[model samples]
Target: MTSVDQPPAFSDGAAVIELLNTSIGYGARAVVDDVSLRIDRGEVVALVGPNGSGKTTIVRGLLGLAPVVGGEVRLFGVPAGRFHERWRIGYVPQRHTVVGAVPSTVQEVVASGRLARRRWWKPPTAADRAVVSRAIDVVGLVDQSRASVSTLSGGQQRRVLIARALAADPEVLVMDEPTAGVDVASAEALTRTLARLVEDGRTLLIVTHDVAPLAPILTRVVAVAGGSVVGDEPARIALSPASALAGGIYAHPGHDPHHLAPDDPAGPAPGPGWLGDPGLRGAPAAS
Candidate 1:
């Protein structure tokens, strides 16, 4: 197992997210303790472990949804607690969290991602609409742009949530269990869409239990168990049964070890850039 005691060397670029010996949980209890992790610009990272392993809690801590009882969490070089340019990071919650009983068009739901970039008193501009449209297209939902989110399949709805995050055009995207509970076909489709995003040079931090489908696009995998990271290694090693067993993470039956190799012709290319504007950075938050 790769040791987490020392920081890994990364390419020259600012870390998009950093957790320094951080402990996070709700109220007074700390779920994960003394965790130090960093995701540099352009890296596609996966936080993998069994359910309740504190992977989700770590993500929550980064988003400030969970209370940080120890250490620090930073976003784009600024302490997360003090960071105001939140528009720089897009988040996609689980699929179930996105759709509700209320009927809403795919376009409407995606456009909402721009809320952090638009002033409340002002309406969405042409550029905003264009960005939303591009996001929808990126997720291959152009035909369903006008379709109600409730009417779509679980996977399509998941794509909607992803499009919603992309609509914000954030530099770094953090997604939780993107392929969870989806049918095989839908999961494959989602993987292809993610491949496109990777090609566009989007920095992604994904939390997932099933990493086989996404193994191709993953650059690194950090295994968390018992509220602490047990293994950190390149995707090639991390996804193997030996490495997984070493970290106490179960390798689900039927997952081919060969797919764990990060050699997908459809995988992400080099560098950090946005979906629409490749050169943009540090986007201002909505007033």
Candidate 2:
């Protein structure tokens, strides 16, 4: 079994992620309201909010995955719509639905990340091969390089997805619900790997309903509510017992905070992070 080691990648110490009054949703009914955000190099930001509060919608807007009704989003300071520096950005979709039946080996899957690094119709360059191998090893998948993707565990699969993002050596990596249903060990491992990325100054923005798995390592948190930002503070502040209690739940099931009436809770309440034990992977999102 070949052992793969982590690599020192880069995020250029650049402010590569931003959103300005960004609004997004299906059809004409907007779910996300005008909101502006910025992420610099060497920082990690988490978006924790009540479900349907437009956290995912905001992320989709930045990725150009969802149409924005107002304001603008910039990647590397260029308008996101016209941003062609695809090679510099990496994204891990919330659903790895495409992995289930795929019969490709781990190396093959990681190597595909290089397609974006090359020109149209050209063969893979030796440098591209090196990057893919390094990416595989960095995500601790070297031993499974030749193994089929269908054979890996859920945690391994998630790591493989992240490796593809890292393989591209992107300046920004945006992930949605990255730790959903993940086991404690796998989630912690992911957090540690991400922490290493921050030490190396690679920017990361993750959208998760639960912050407990991510808070200890977070540099900041952007809490979304009512389709707009209600709080933009350090993770500790945003997830404070006082704040968390009043904020309802970030990513709670069947949540629709927009229509739900509000009432201020009288006192601080226990929560995912405030429980004092680094809790386990949170409840799963409904089907």
Candidate 3:
């Protein structure tokens, strides 16, 4: 328990996760279209875009949760659909999954991540317990281990879900909206925990509308729009997380202008230039 486990084997120059010429969707609907992306080992890549932009669908394609209508997906050099090593990848789904009225405890929920490695009918081993305990400690939830998940706040429950993913001893973590709806304190806690994970050499692919809290540790940013990868580049620029969030890093810059008319019900809603106005870019005002 004192040392992190070694990363799984991968071929030279091979990406930890890859989607090549892929299209993913539900029945008769291709939500993510013709996307090609790669995440190398130990890289923290943020997938940012507007709602219905297929960011989550791309992740689902990687996890084999969505239908891959075309092309290929690979994890650690193995085809995603054929990859059997589930524990090598950890996933924290959107918050709604944990908000349900379930009677499970934090510890029990976290421990369930170990189920993939444990035998169907056998009980958890000493190693499983050690890892679960370590995971709880990693997320700063040792004191709340036994607390019922339903009793916890939305943010606390989110931390519990993170601990659950860590309990699997994964080399790559895929998360959707890690800080959405979370309070300031919980968001800070999550940021610190994620930084520690990156230091520990774990890779992360997070789909988020705001990367403000994660700016310090982020290595790259991948922008998805119209169900496609619009931007994929290094995030090593001078922009701080807060500034990036403010500077339209997550804004749907390509949104149609006609949709922002004054009388349109879908027009400029609120909160940080929801209307995608050009003035939001901090341009010089006309004389």
Candidate maximizing TM-score: 1
lDDT of 3 by residue, 1-287 (tens): 00012222231244788787899999989999988887878888889888899999999888888999988888888998789997889999987446546698889999988888888999888999999998988886777788888887777788888888999999999998887776434555576678789888899999877655565567777778799877655655413334343244535532343321223454333334332333212212110
Model 3 ranges with Cα > 4 A deviation: 1-12, 96-102, 238-250, 253-287
Lowest summed-lDDT stretch of 10 residues in model 2?
1-10
Error of 1 at 286 (Å): 31
Better of 1 and 2 by lDDT: 1
TM-score of each: 0.83, 0.78, 0.79
Q: Rank the candidates by lDDT, best first.
A: 1, 3, 2
Candidate 3 clash pair list? none
**Tens digit of per-residue lDDT, candidate 1, span 123-182:** 999999999998988777787789888887677788889989998899888999897776
lDDT score for residue 20 of model 3? 79
Query: Which pairs of residues have clashing backbones in candidate 2?
Result: 21-35
Give the root-mean-square deviation of each candidate in angstroms.
7.5, 10.0, 11.6
